[model samples]
Target: MTTVKVKLTHKNYDVKIEKGLHQAIGEQVRSVWQPRKVVLITDSNVGPLYLSSAQGQLEKAGFEVLPVEVPAGEASKSLTKVGEIISQMAQAGFTRQDGVISLGGGMVGDLSGVVASLYMRGIAFIQIATSLTAQVDSSVGGKTAVNLGETKNIAGTFYQPDLVLVDSDYLDTLTDRDLVEGYGEVAKTSALEGQDFFNFTGKIRSVQDIRDHAPELSERSIAYKAKVVMGDEKEAGQRQFLNFGHTFGHAIELLSHGSLRHGEAVAIGMVTVTRVFEAEGISPEGLTQALIDRLQAVGLPISSDLVGTPLFFQHMINDKKNRGGVINMVALAQVGQPIIVPKPLDEIRSMI
Candidate 1:
């Protein structure tokens, strides 16, 4: 078991990473939260697989578990779904002291976090991350949000979880593509952390290989992200490095009309941004190709056909990271070194 502590000004929580911890979640929750009406939110794909074990454990531990399942995909991260979850919690008489449990991947964690944040002003929440993307990225950070229209995570908050339970066993049910989708995040984190992580992931070629090394890979990734979150809880400074591939990634997500997965979009985003930076002579030469080789080795896209299109242009302009008519894209100084470069919209567009 690897326990990483995330210390913020408002609260501090532990990210518990252990294989097969899913069956013991009830006892774990009991340790941190008192018995209460705990609402567990999951998605279609995950609910049938592990929901019963998680819910049964919580119920056995005396928590009033209210299990809810959303459609499986990025579409569920919206105000409409959040309203439905809130309505259910309200009807069940949940209150400020009640807790929420996110029992699936990134969308589940993000939506559940926001619901917990808004319900009765605020409520305690726990993350039982079932996907690599959630365990390593979304679940650790205090960033909880619901996408609004074409904007991803446009409506959200920096609300920390009371506990994060990451059990790598959940990866067993994932399809090959699902595992590959997560490697994009693994790639991003490795790039920002250092060359050691970069090389570790570079050698992994298959999604099954990624799953084979889940526990250690997840523990390492979570710790790096936790360290960043601890230092910049609100994304005011150092935390932005965590968005290494996100600037253009979010735009790619919007332009895909929900076809591309988040991590996959970020994979191409990392490549796109690296290529742009290398062309501008800001990044060291071969940085783009080096990054591309690893991403492609894991079956992630290294470029997009929409890069110079009009829709891509519009979404990049509307990116959430933009401020005062300038956009900030995280560029790689090398495999493990990241730098944030702020540029005008036109300058960014010309690179694409």
Candidate 2:
């Protein structure tokens, strides 16, 4: 088992990563949180697979568990779902002392975190990140959110979890497409982490390679994020690097409707935005192609027809990362060096 500690100004927590760690969820939770009634949130797809075992473990560890299941997918990340979960917790007689345990993937983790943050103002929550995306990116860093309408992660908060447990064993059941979606985020992180990690990720040409290096990938991604979060928790400065592909990615993601997964859109965003900056001579010549090679090596898409359209132009202007009237896009001077470049709305439209 490897533990990464996230130290913040108001709170600090540990992200624990290991194989088969799912089997010991109860003991791990008991070690950190006092005994209390906990709400275990899962989804349709994952409930049948591991919900019973997770509930049993938590029960054995002396926690009173209420298993709440929701539909599985991106659509579940909404205010309507958040309201329903909060209503369930209220009916169960939960308080700030009691906590929430997210037992599924990123959707469950993000949804549960938002619930925990809003319940009685705020309560404790544990992240048992099951999916690759959850384990690598969303489960750490304390950014809890739900998509508002078509805008992704529009309603959210920076609520840190009490503890995070990432079990790679849970990823074994994921579909090939799901693994590819997650590799998008992994590739993004590796690109921002510099040459050593990027080179390591460049060798991963298949899903089997990801399965082989799950623990190492999870550990390194969490460790790098912990370092960045410690320096800038609220995204006022350095933390924005984590949004390497997100600015334009979020725009294209909205435009893609349901066809594109978040990581897939981010894969496209990284390459597309890099291409624009490269043409402007801001980013180096090879940066865009490098991203394309690394992303395609893992079967992640690097471009989309939806990009450069009128709708795409409007969406980019409305991105949450933009401040005032300036559209801020994350650009790489090279691997490991990310910069935020602001552009005029007309300038952005011209690029499209």
lDDT of 2 by residue, 56-164 (tens): 9999999999999999988999999999989988998998799999998889999999999999999988999988999999999889989987778889999999899
TM-score of candidate 2 versus the correct structure, residues matched by position: 0.97
**Candidate 1 — what's its lDDT?**
0.87
lDDT of 2: 0.88
Worst 10 residues of 1 by lDDT: 311-320
**RMSD to native for every prediction?**
1.1, 1.1
TM-score of each: 0.98, 0.97
Clashes of 1: 0
